[model samples]
Target: MQGLIISALIAIGVIVLLGMTIRIVPQRNVYVVERLGKYRTSLEAGMHILMPFIDKVAYKHSLKEIVRDVPRQSCITKDNIEVSIDGVMYLQVIDPKSASYGVDDYVMAAQQLAQTTLRSVIGKIDLDKTFEERSEINMEVVQAVDEAAQPWGVKVLRYEVADINLPASIKDAMEKQVRAERERRAVVAESEGDRQAAINRSEGDRQAAINRSEGEKQEMINISEGEKMKQINEAEGRARQIELIAQATATGLREVATAVKEDGGEEAVSLRIAEQYVSAFEKLAKESTTLLLPSNLSDVGGTVAGLQKVLKTIDRTQP
Candidate 1:
């Protein structure tokens, strides 16, 4: 009975020792081992054997990337404006041993460092630039924190400013400024439209005036041309009438000359001259209401002789 109990106790002790010696670490995780309260080695993701009661896992660190939120804090800009800012930081533990021993708390240190760097970056620029240069500020924070975290086995990949809070007064002022600028632009646009409309109206008036002047000029030209044509036609008609009158007078004179050469022409001409002389005396007596007599009223033959001589001279001169 005593020997059976001793074998059973040995088997139970062996099982407890094996259970204490063997360790299995998960993937992407590192275990920092310490021997007798001093850091010995860092165990990777695999099965590890350690002497029982001698080696212990001091710290466990994940190699995976982590995201940490930086607490919101108030900062003053170069333009003397107070603004609240907050961000997120991407970090990874590169060395488990250093991460465990180099710093009291690397995560808290990184967060505090990021806050300080962000404040510093914000203080260097004005309020307007703070809103516009957020990426630059984030990059600067990452650079500053990453440099400071080297000994702590923390790698800061990047930083991003998540939110920026501005005062209500400042927001209202900005809105007013934008509204005023828009109103000024609208006024300028309306003025430009009015100016363009005035120019168009003036141009139209000028064109219309020109067209009216052209029409007037054309009308004057037509009138003048018509007057010239009328004058020419009148002159031509006058000339044609004068020509017809001259031709009728010439034909009458020719017929009289031909009749004078016909039978008994001398007797007929002498009688006609005597009759014209008597008719002239009668007309003078009636118009003057006085007695008018020839120097020799009985010398009718002498007057006839004078008229025949005048007629003979005319016939010789006419062709």
Candidate 2:
């Protein structure tokens, strides 16, 4: 009976010991084992054997990516503008042993570090840069957190600044600045167009003035040329008239000399000369209103005697 009791007790003790030594770790999970209050080894997924009273499972962590939202925290920008920023971070445990011993609480440490680093980085940049460059801020936060968490066996894969909060006054000011800039550009463009138009109009006016002046100059030149031609014609007509008068005077003198040299009797010549003079006077009277009178009536006898001598000479020369 005692042997039966001892066997039953041994079986119960074996079962309890087996329970203490054996551990079932689920997939995507890690267990940090500690022996005698010190880190011994890390156990992965599947069955693991742990020495009773010698080795203990200290911490269990999931290897899968974990995401948490960082709460909004006030930060001061480089330009001394106060802002509130919030973001999310993705992290995973790499070494379970280090994760258990390297840090007290990885999640709390990461959250606080992320907030501090976010403020520090944002404080180094202006408000405009902070508002415009969210991705850069996110990357800076991720890098800082990853570097700090490296010793804790935690890998910070990525982080993102989801939203930023700004003062109403700043938002209004930015909007006004944009509107003013657009208006200024519009005014400049309009002024430039006006200036160009004025230049074109001035050029056109100058060209028109030049054309009018040229036309006036051409007209004056034509008038001067016409006057010159008219003057030339007048001079040529006066020269022709002088030449005709000289020719007629020479012919008249030659006829008078021929008549005198001929041996026509003076009385006969005087009668002929009188008749020729009357004919010329009658011709002049028909063409003009002015009358020509003899300068001396007593000289008429001398003129008749001279003509008779001229006729006699002409008659003698006929032989």
| Candidate number with greatest lDDT | 1
Candidate 2 residue-wise lDDT, 131-173, digit = tens:
6898899999999999999999999998899888888998888
Candidate 2 achieves a global lDDT of 0.87
lDDT of 1 by residue, 256-308 (tens): 66666788876788898899999999888888967868788899988998887
Off by over 4 Å in 2: 1-17, 185-319
lDDT of each: 0.92, 0.87
Q: Quote each prediction's TM-score.
A: 0.61, 0.54
As a whole number from 0 to 100, the lDDT of residue 35 in candidate 2 is 90
lDDT for model 1, please.
Answer: 0.92
For model 1, what is the error of residue 180's alpha carbon versus the real structure, in angstroms, after optimal superposition? 2.3
Which ten-residue region of model 1 has the weakest summed lDDT?
252-261
